[model samples]
Target: MSLTKEQLLDYYRKMRNIREFEETIHRENTTGEIPGFLHLYCGEEANAVGVCAHLSDDDYIASNHRGHGHCVAKGSDPRLMVMELYGRAEGLCGGKGGSMHIADLDRGSLGANGIVGAGAPLATGAALTQKVKGRDNVSVCFFGDGASNEGYVFEAMNLAVILKLPVIFYCENNGVGEGTGVDYAVGADSIADRAAAFGMPAKKIDGTDFFSVYDAMEEVVAHCRAGNGPYFVEAETVRFYGHFEGDPQKYRLKEEIDNAKLHRDCLKKFRSRVIEEGLATTEEFDSIDSDLVAAYKGYVAEAKQAAWPRPEALTEDVYITY
Candidate 1:
């Protein structure tokens, strides 16, 4: 499907938002203000924005630890996300879930999981619900290469195909899975190849290119919505930061990281493509960036002043009373 100029600009805006938000969090985390561990989604913006652009609030998505991008792409409010990171009561998840557990049911984001490979089953269950209810909506599970190696991911894939569930198993293979390289960890030729063994269609694409990811998602979404069962996508992407905040990153060389940032950055690639195709201008992109910067300033300011959850409220929302 060809994207309109407006759509192209919107994609750029979302990717830019993810980049800016992650970078801002990285800066803030250094000051010891934001509590908890943060897994920044710096270089994997295209995978989230491209895939989520094809989805709506009716569609469900389960995210992994690096999930701020998915939340932003799926239309979650960054203001509330900032507040959540700040542990403010007004934040999403009431300031309890923090970075790895931000969920907005209204937007169909099933929260980010701290446990690796946990979201696959959640999305599978959501897709099962959609099928049982006779709805056309689909569910997507965004997991990393590390999670792809987990046994439950394969179980989710086999179950989804057997039941013909409308769930897309999206894997972002960012080379390293928490300091361990994908080359040394995954025992298959590729994650997509491994997923295909479950009797579902699978494809691997250049996750760094927004257009490639978006186009492939278009086909994958159509297949699932048509009741053709599950699909798998392995996105070959990169992560700019360490596995987590404060990681020494002794596993890889500094030069390798520097080269990827300079040559394979998705934001730069998107800007160049759109401008070269005459679909967008430099000033237009610049305006969006400026607006995002100003808006983030407001979000950060409000979060700093936002209230914290009361001590007695810890028991609230922990259980349901019928």
Candidate 2:
């Protein structure tokens, strides 16, 4: 609410970009243009944008398989991301790391990991570096409800609390964790409760609402930057798509998916709030949406025409010499 009109519009633009980018990937994947496994970040836009909005380039974040949104919100070039997915040499990773592994260190993205629960320790280590060097920058580890059950996640939480590191253990609890319901898999009452058991401050919010996520993260980021140690946040969101592109999603009921898409869409909620508050007009939002569609089309076309990495370059950047 304290955000200016421009800030609200920027939020809408970022969320729309993520939605368009993911939807475009979904379409291109079916056509065999994008390579490898892609876990689309269709409905989880607010969580990434809201959190990263409070962060600076000095801060760090590690992400899960569904990471395009995080990369975009963190300021990675979508053109480079598209190129990466297409396996072009011009990609952020030189085409070696595909959809699941895109990283932009310059943007403070530690890269998206294919292995579940891998980002926890990575972010924790980054936070430790900040503390050691007496920097105020914090680190955030974006994991899902599925990754919450991993041992290393809990390990990272405990270490963070013990060291009082500036890190946030963010759980994007989208109800279902890759076909396994969180109810059946998560032993605790909730992911936040499980994290609270680690002696860190914890809370859960509606991830679909950008304001809710942004406000909660504002306080959390401030707390960490002030040297109050780690915090835990579980954003209960919904993914409009399946676990992966082409996933049958038989584990989810049709009505459940439909209800979430209609009632809990983050972009819709954001637009309504901004418009009702007289902060932005529908025409403004529509302009952003239209511009993104055309821009993404261009990204795809350029990526398709980009060159592949040379074979000799494969052994390059794979190691460091003394």
Candidate 3:
């Protein structure tokens, strides 16, 4: 489905937000202000923004360690996100979740997981809740290609299909799971083939192209929301950063990064498409860019000034009701 002018602007805004947010995190991480590890989603912006464009707060999403993009795309506040990264009292999780465990359940973001393939079960459980509640909401499970190799992901897939749950397994195959390439770790040429083996319909799209991911998601999400059980989408893309902020990236070649930036930047590809199609004007795009820069800068300033959560509260929220 082609996006309307308003939808185009929204998609562009979300993508820009993810980009600026990551860059801000990188800057803060360098200054040693951000606590714990951060897995920035610098290059793979399209997969999150595109798929999430089709969702609302009523729908749930389970995110992996590299989940800032997903959280921002799903309407979690950016200022809160920055505060969370800074371990501030104003953070979404009140500085408790830090980077990897940041979450806002009211917005339907279950949480950003620290464990590999952990999101699958949570998403499956959410789908089950929706089914039992007789709600027409779908759940999205976002994981890396590396997480796809885990037993939990496969088990979740089987359970989701068997129960005919409304879930979409979004595999952002950015070629690597940590430092190892997905080709070396997954033991499969394409993740779609694996989905097919489980009797699930899967689609593979170029993750660097927003329209490709967005358009494909429109179809797949609609199918799942219609009680067609789970659908799988494997997005082929690349990440510009290493496994972590301070990673030397010794495992990857410099040429790969250069190639992705030059030819496979998803935001660039999206901007080009909307302009070429006359769906959005260049001035509109520029205005959005300017607004995003200002907004991100403001968030960074506020987050830095915000106080960290109280030391006494560190022991809170360890159990639900016990």
Candidate 4:
């Protein structure tokens, strides 16, 4: 279905939010204000926000190491996220998780996993619980193409199907898996096809297009929510940053990155579509841009001044009732 005016505005806002948030992390990390290796999701904004638009607080999502976008889209607090990146005690997970493990259970975000394909099982388990309880809630597992090759992901899929768990296996195919393209690792051209082999519903969509991803996800999510079992969606996307903060990205060609930026930019495409449909005015978008600039600047300033995590927290949140 074509997006309405409100949906269009929401899509634009989310894509822009992800872009701005990632860009902020990039700038701060480069200046040595934020600690640890950070992978910015500057270029793949739509894939996260679009797929997540159909979800709710009752629903769940599992994220990859590059998970800030998913966290924000799933309704995480921006201030806490920034504090987490800053390794402050007020940060999410009490600054114990850092960039790779930021999570808020209250918001239904199942924490970004450090090991590839690790989140699939967690999401599947969540879905299983929801299913046993007869809840309509669904779980979405956000993994990269690289994670698609993991044995755990495969096992999770089979288990979810056997239990008829309402889970969506979301594959963000950003062309490369930390330098090696999916083509080099995955034998199939379509990740969705692989999901079908496991006897589940599957489809592929242009991850760079917000409306396309949103519409497609609505269908898949609906099917899953109706107790039709698990589904798979492969989003064709691209990341502008290196595997982490400081890697040289020598495996990729400069020309390829530039080309993706020009043709496959999700934010640019969202702007064009909204403008072309006359559903939103350029002035409206410009207003959002202005607000974003101020918001990001404010977040960075506050984060830089926030207190760092205390050494005593090293043993906290590791185990319950230990």
User: What's the CA error at residue 61 for candidate 2, in Å?
Assistant: 0.2
Residue-by-residue lDDT tens digits, candidate 4, 146-247: 999999999999999998999999999898898898888889877778987899888899988887788899899999899999998998888898999897
Full-model lDDT for every candidate: 0.94, 0.94, 0.90, 0.88
Q: Among all windows of ten consecutive residues in candidate 4, which has the lowest summed lDDT? A: 1-10
lDDT of 1 by residue, 215-314 (tens): 9999999999999999999999999999999999999999999999998899999999888988889999999999999888888888988899998779
Q: What digit string (tens of lDDT, one per residue) describes model 3 on residues 1-322?
A: 3457898898888998899999888987888877789899988999999888889999999999999999999999988988888888999989888889878899999989999999998999999999999888999999999999999999999999999999999999999889998878877888878998888999999998988888899999899888889999999988989888999999999998999899898888888888898888889999998998898888888888998778888888888888
- Candidate 1: give the clashing pairs: none
Residue 146, model 1: lDDT of 93
Q: Could you tell me the lDDT of residue 25 within candidate 3?
A: 85
Give the RMSD in angstroms, all C-alphas superposed, for model 2.
0.8
**Ranking according to TM-score, highest score first:** 2, 1, 4, 3
Question: In candidate 4, residue 213 scores what lDDT?
Answer: 86
- TM-scores vs. true structure, each candidate: 0.98, 0.99, 0.97, 0.97
In candidate 3, stretches whose alpha carbon ends up further than 4 angstroms from where it belongs are: 320-322
